[model samples]
Every structure is written in C-alpha cells, then in structure tokens.
Target: MSTFFHIHHDGDAHGPEAQRIHTELIEPVMRDLEERGRLDRFYVLNFSGPRPFVRLIVEPRESHGSNLAREVLASLRSRARELDFLGEHDIQPQGKVA
Candidate 1:
C-alpha cells in the first residue's frame, strides 16, 4: 500500500518553512528508507490553490508494506509537531492506495 501526508502552507511553495520541512524532516527519513531498501518510490508534489500544499507520497517495498509507511508517517508527525511546522490539524491522510 501507499500512504501520503498533505502538508498545507499559507506561504509560497519556496518559503523557508516549506524548505525546512523538506530538508529537515522529509529528506532524512527518505534517505534512511532508501539506504535500508525499504522504499519502493516517493514523490513530493506541490500545488498552489486556495490552500497551497505539498503532498508527500511514500510507497514502501512489498516486503515492508504499509507497516513501514505507518511508522514513517508517525515519525514525520512527531518531528513536524516538534519543529512547530505542523499542528494536529495540519496533516490529513488520504487513505491507502494500492
């Protein structure tokens, strides 16, 4: 399965806050997953709309599956909260995609 996190922002896509989340939180986790061979594919999608946002998609290897995605999502939630970039309502899951 594939899981995703939608990160909403009020500022521009290239703003410091967005960059920080990408660099400080997302990249490191992605690198670790890649190094461990637990990742299938990942995508960072940016959108500009009434509520500008970024979508982080993580598809783990079948051997790891949704469990790995769940763990990654949890870790990201915690880190985002700690960094004050995300609040409880900031992230919304779009459910599992096969």
Candidate 2:
C-alpha cells in the first residue's frame, strides 16, 4: 500500500505556474527526502478539474515506518509556506491505498 497527498491548487494544472511549482518547489523537497533515504518511491500527478491538483503518491521506506508519509507531507507543506505558495494551495493527506 501507499499513501497519497493531494496538493490542491487554485490554478491551471497545465499552466506554467504549475510547472514552476513542480520544478521549483515540489521537486526540491522530494529530492531532498529521497537523498535522505526517507522514502522508497514517489510520484507526482497533475490533474485538471474544478479544482486543479497535484497528487503525490509516496511509498515510505519500511524501516522508517508509516509516519514517513505524514512527515513528508508536513515537510512539503512547510516548504510551500516558506516559499509563499501555501496561500494559493493546500496539502491534504488522502490516507492509505492498496
């Protein structure tokens, strides 16, 4: 199973802004976590709808336990706030999945 975190943004999913967010914001954080060996695998999905969103599917390192997902989510949220992006988006834990 894996845990998913949905980062709902109030903007176009396929816009340059979304690409910037992924490259400048999300990627850096995910890369850092990966370097720290905190996660087994992670994926980012861009979705367009009434409320466009970026979904993060994370598989935590078994040695790190389930809390790793929550930790990563918190880190992303914190980084977003630091980068002044949280005001336009929200990160929510979508729970576990098979």
Candidate 3:
C-alpha cells in the first residue's frame, strides 16, 4: 500500500542535527526503497513562514509488498526521535485513497 508521510519541523531544516538525521537515517532507508524498486515517487517541498520546514513526498512502488510502509516508517521515526523531533514535530501517514 502507498501512503503520504509527513514530517513537520518547528526548527531549522538545514541545521546540523537535521542534516545528520537525513544523512544517517532517512537517506539510507530511502536508498533501500529505491534499490528494491519500491519507490514510486519522491519530492522535497519548502514553505516559508515564521516556522519553516520541508515536506517530503514518498509514494510506494506499484508492485510493492505489504511491509513497505512499515519499513519506511520505522526508519524515519527512529531518527526523528533521536533528533528530539517527536513532540514539537510530527510524523504521520496519510492513507492513499482508493
């Protein structure tokens, strides 16, 4: 199944910690998904405001297995918490509509 995952940050998206998390945690999992041919679509969007952050778009590959969502979420969540982002930030999946 495919879903939209959002990570809203209240801090600096280009900060040192954010960069580390992306490099160490998020990127690896994304690369895995790509290698598995289970990554359908991806994007990085930015919004400017008093609180600025980036939104990432990930679409599961059409022929993916049942566990693709779980795998992706697990990888992102682990690093988000490590960066102290679970509270001020948010990570949730938007179910794909049939």
Candidate 4:
C-alpha cells in the first residue's frame, strides 16, 4: 500500500543540528522512497513562533506496501531526541487511496 505521511514536531526546524539531522537521517529515507518509486515528494516545513512547529510531508507514488507513516515517525522521533529539540513532537498520519 502506498501512503502520504505527515509528521509534526515541536523543535527548531532550521537550527544547525536540526538541519544536520534533516540532511542525514531524514533525507536518506526520502532517497530510498524515491528509488523505490514510492516517493512523489518529500520535504520538511517550519513554522515561526516561540513554540516552533516542524513537519515533513511524504507523498507516495502508489498505495501499496506503504510504511511512510511508520518510517517518518521513527525519523522524527530519533532526530528530535538527538537534536535535543526544545519541544516535543506529535506525529500525524494521513493517507488517500489512489
């Protein structure tokens, strides 16, 4: 099954360490997804505020064997910890059949 995964986190999405994690951990996942033809687009978004908001959107090419939600959860979870994100995160999954 294919999936479109949306991840939400409270952190400094643009900070140096956050950027490192984004490039290293998160980008790799998106790479694998693209290679498998399961990735339409993957990207991180940031919000401006005292309480920062960060998110990654995963758009899959097909809805078969989709584990984007799980994968994204892991990425966000791990990176946030390593980066010591000032805020916690809430991961949300959204899917649509194509």
Task: Compare the candidates by TM-score and give the number of the best one.
Answer: 2
lDDT of 2 by residue, 1-98 (tens): 57888888878998876786688777888788789988788888999999888888888788875578767777887888888876534878785522
Off by over 4 Å in 4: 1-13, 65-67, 75-98
lDDT of 1 by residue, 1-98 (tens): 77887878776777776787688878887888889999988888777778877789888899998578677877777877777776756666677623
lDDT scores of the candidates, listed in order:
0.78, 0.78, 0.63, 0.58
lDDT comparing candidate 2 with the true structure: 0.78
- TM for candidate 3 is 0.61
What's every prediction's RMSD, in angstroms?
2.4, 2.7, 3.7, 4.7
TM-score of 2: 0.86
Give the count of colliding residue pairs in each prediction.
0, 0, 0, 7
What does candidate 1 score on TM?
A: 0.81
lDDT of 4 at 87: 30
Tens-digit lDDT string for candidate 3 (1-98):
44666665566667754555456656777887898788876665554466555556677777664667766777678766676655423665557422
Which ten contiguous residues of candidate 2 have the minimum total lDDT?
89-98
Off by over 4 Å in 2: 96-98
Of 1 and 3, the candidate ahead on TM-score is 1
Report the lDDT tens digits of candidate 4 across residue range 1-98.
33444344444657764565467657876787688776688767765566554456666666634565676566556665675653334444555422
